[model samples]
Target: MPASHSSYDSGDEPRPRHVAIIMDGNGRWARARGLPRVAGHRQGVEAVRRTIKAAGEAGVEVLTLYSFSSENWRRPRAEVDELMGLLRRYLKSEIADLHGRNIRFRMIGERDGLAADILTLIDEAERMTGSNDAMTLVLALNYGGRQDIARAARNIAESVHRGLLRPEAVDDELFSSYLSTAGLPDPDLLIRTSGEKRISNFLLWQCAYAEMVFIDKFWPDFDADDLAAAMDEFAGRERRFGSTANGR
Candidate 1:
């Protein structure tokens, strides 16, 4: 099928190079099945595997997943410990497979907040996969978009104070260079699984024009076909980017 344009004109279909996702509803999925919440998290890991493979297959250059939010620490200590343990297990089990696929793995968030062992594993993963060229897999663990922006602002201020950068020269592009995702391209598409309609503090500044896709399927159940459907939907969008469809 040809692409759809809700605006004035349509031309070639758009292809998203980078995609970000907010994986939600694991607890709900577990509760619905009368299973423990940890079970839901385990299932979510499977979903992450499927989604990353799908993104790679679809020719997406970058994929960012909100694995754990900073606010997640407020949950019960047992759950927190379980989540961290699962993260370590995933890194240990998946790093070899991910390397085989030539995918670069990276994580963002406050390293100080992570357990020492987990932090070591995360650093090792990045170093091992740093040279891979196929695709980049970014995991936003213990991340919060607002916090990210705040940190960027703080960096920018420090630079200005040090006379490295003039406050007057700070534009969007300049400011973006101070962000954690400094060298990365903005996400072209943003997906939220488990039917959550809100962004929930994922990629706040970086996803300004990203085409949003919300899928009803729980994280564990969303697979390649679901990602393809989202891509198809994205390919049919018209990105104005402050200009008309016909390039006014």
Candidate 2:
């Protein structure tokens, strides 16, 4: 889509092509409830389940969740292990049902620190759901927008040096093709929970023109209704995409 003529700008689509979410405030939610942070994380997983179904129902082709970031590793080792354990359990048990529902699963980010079994499970899930066309659910685990850009830059430079690509050929589309989300459309809507107003380095390049919505509620409290309301808000606005009010 043209920057000046996106689906929203043209009013051609009922909803966004892709919705990206920064699932924040799990620890704070747990702290407020006087419960362990893992409890909130578990509940956040449930929110993910609801959002997946809701996004699919809302006709969103792709849904991306900022499940974990590179900075997340700075946390205590115990918490990290627990989070990894939760991820393991989710993958071990959820893949079959997700496949049956025809929802394709995709994970972006470096897999360097992940366990062998987890990597195997992720590969299997992708292969099994690769053919599904109903919807796509992307999980950004251990992902960093800066790191992604840097990686792509290194690869592009190498390609140029090897005579496989020309430096003059580098452009927005070409750079995007080098990223992890090479084939996926750029997110049209970005949501951050717990009243966070920052993008937090998520989708730094892809969200250049995305409409952002911040929710006051924590990740665990988000539901289908919240998703619907966000879309309604998006629908009411006129996306100019850097154009003037008349889109000239």
Candidate 3:
């Protein structure tokens, strides 16, 4: 049976095969407890681990995480430096375990801004696990939906300028192929922690038909039960993709 075609509840509704998460509220989680922001970020890693295991258990085929946004560079210099160091450490320590779990790793974002060493590390990780089949874990670092769309548009324009693509032939599918997420399926469910109601410039076009799940739990505080709740809620939704609930 196909992944999305199965339902955990009675096999009636379609289960979300791909789930995208915007992990938010790290600073707030720290502030609420009078702890340093770094503490919250550290605990957030635990949440990531838990979420990954939970996703695997739920049979979700793809899990995309918005790790660091392009705008995050505007944060305090010290904090940004700390985050980079933490990311490097996490990558080094977790790659083996991720590969062992049959997780295909991929990073989505412009690579020019990253340090050459970090870029190489990311490349190595991608190359090492490109053939995994259990599940794919995509980390969106320094990513922005607007930037992705703009890049896709630029590519389309270049193709048209070179007479490779006719302007009249452009459509949704064609435009999407020019994006970084060209060969990936769109997220079936989008979850944002910290009760944030907005998409925050994360997958604007790809999430057009995704069921949204907003939770009040902070990223560090989120756990497997939280994921289950989100999945349950998603299973209850009627995703018509602009059509009626009856699939009309």
Candidate 2 C-alpha lDDT tens digits along 1-248: 22432434344656789999999989999999999999999999999989998887777899999988999999999899999999999998888998998999999998999889889999999999999989999989899999999999999999999999988999999999999999999999999999989999899999999999999999999988888778877877788889989867
Ranking by lDDT: 2, 3, 1
Using TM-score, give the best candidate's number.
3
Of the two candidates 1 and 2, the one with more favorable TM-score, higher being better, is 2
How do the residues 126-200 of candidate 1 rate in per-residue lDDT, one tens digit apiece? 999999989999999989899999999998888889999888999999888887887889999999988979999
* TM-score for candidate 1, residues paired by index: 0.93
Q: What clash pairs does model 3 have?
A: none
List lDDT for all candidates, in order. 0.87, 0.90, 0.90
| lDDT string, candidate 3, 22-98, tens digits | 99999999999999999889999889998998888778899999999999999999889888888899899998899
**Weakest lDDT window of 10 consecutive positions for candidate 3:** 1-10
State the TM-score for model 3.
0.94
Candidates 1 and 2, the one with greater lDDT:
2
